[model samples]
Target: MKPSAFEYHRPTTPEEAAELLAEFGDDAKVIAGGQSLMPMLNFRLAVFEHLIDIGRLTDLTGINHDSGSVAIGAITNQATVGRSALIRTSVPLLSRATPLIGHFPIRNRGTLGGSVAHADAAAEYPAVALTLDAEIETLSSAGRRTLPAAEFFIGMWTTALRDDEILTKVTFPIREGRSGFSIAEFSRRKGDFAMAGACVAVKVDNDLRVESCSIGLFGLGSMPIRATSAERSLVGCSIDELQVRDVAHAAVSGLESVPADLHGSAAYRVRVGATMVARALKSALEEATDD
Candidate 1:
């Protein structure tokens, strides 16, 4: 199947892209890499009257790190991210999770902003963004504004970005001190979307006691969710004394809606999700202790 007929506008600059979006309003959709959008369009799951192509906008493609965080330009592709030493060093979780997003061909054409903005519940980047509490930056003719990751994703395949707004950058705070991160998921194959998955970030003291931990669960909710209940339980416990399985249970305990489909039942997905959480937490703890 082919996408519905639409006008394509290839903007040379981010501002020009924003102007095109503003002009077309709800009828326009930005295409960068088009790895995700093209599939949806081909299936007719999504339709737009105008496709404002930002894939070639160099102004929206780069990686920069400051004192506190690293900001990645929206058009930066996943293949670049996977190879970037800065991303691997500054945001290890993201780098580690890169190959988990489909296969290399998809990653070669998939953009960071496109994935985050697509907001797929089972995607690794969204879960990592939530786990790291990254900041999402957007631009419009009106002005620019930033939003916390938690507030940025409001629903399935939906975000807080307005129709006329363009996502310009995503900033992830640097993890310093005793920190470790890991992501785990259960899929049919290496490139398949997880039936359930978890992204874990941990900060521990010298004695191997937990200082702070974040568990972001995906594929078990309407959006990627922070396992707050589970996190609260682990923050004060020693790794030796803590029950990894118990923490994983707590991670899925607070979930209200775990969608059941032909893929799996709600109970089955929650169980898989819990297992992934346990695997991720254990791996993260090992890394943290090694530090």
Candidate 2:
């Protein structure tokens, strides 16, 4: 099936995109990589009268790193992000998660902002953002605003972005100490959506005690679940098998509200989620110790 007829507007700048969104209101939909949106449009799941194409907006096309954080432009392709040396060194968690997003061809066209905006429960970018406490920046006719990842994702396929706002970039803090990052997901095929996944970022001190830790779970809830309870439990604990198991249990304990679907039962998802968390934590611990 093809998308219904719509008025297409190619905006060269983010300001122009914001104006188009404000002019069209709810009738306007922004298109970046169009990987997710095009599928929804083709399936008739989403219909809009106006399509604002921001694919050529040079303002939203690069990755910039500073002393404090790394800012990734909204329209930057996933492939570019995955291959970036800056991201690999500064925001390694994001770099590790990018390859797990989709196949090479899909990543070539999928945008980082598109994935975050789409808010797919099983998407890698959102989970990474949540784990890293990233900030999302948006532009609108009223001006600009930044939202933490925790507040940006409201629900499944939902976000705090206003109708007249266009997401311009995402900023992730650079971990300053010895840090390790790991991503683990259970997918039926290489490019398929995950049944359960975990993203772990951990910083350990000289004594191997956790200085800071962030855990984000995907494919287990309405949105990416930041396993804060589990993180708190491991903050001062030594990285070991026993501590990892306990942390995994704490993370899964928050899955009391996860809904079951055709892929797995609630019980199965919880189990898989816990196992993924354990694996991720162990891998992160190894990397942290090595670092």
Clashes of each: 0, 0
The positional error of residue 34 in candidate 1, measured at the CA in angstroms, is 0.6
Against the true structure, whose lDDT is highest? 1
Q: What value does the lDDT take at residue 9 in candidate 2?
A: 100
Stretches of candidate 1 off by over 4 Å are: none
Q: Deviation in angstroms for 96 in model 1?
A: 0.7
Colliding residue pairs in candidate 2: none
Q: Which stretches of candidate 2 lie above 4 Å from their native place? A: 240-242
TM-score of each: 0.98, 0.97
Whole-structure CA lDDT of model 2: 0.92
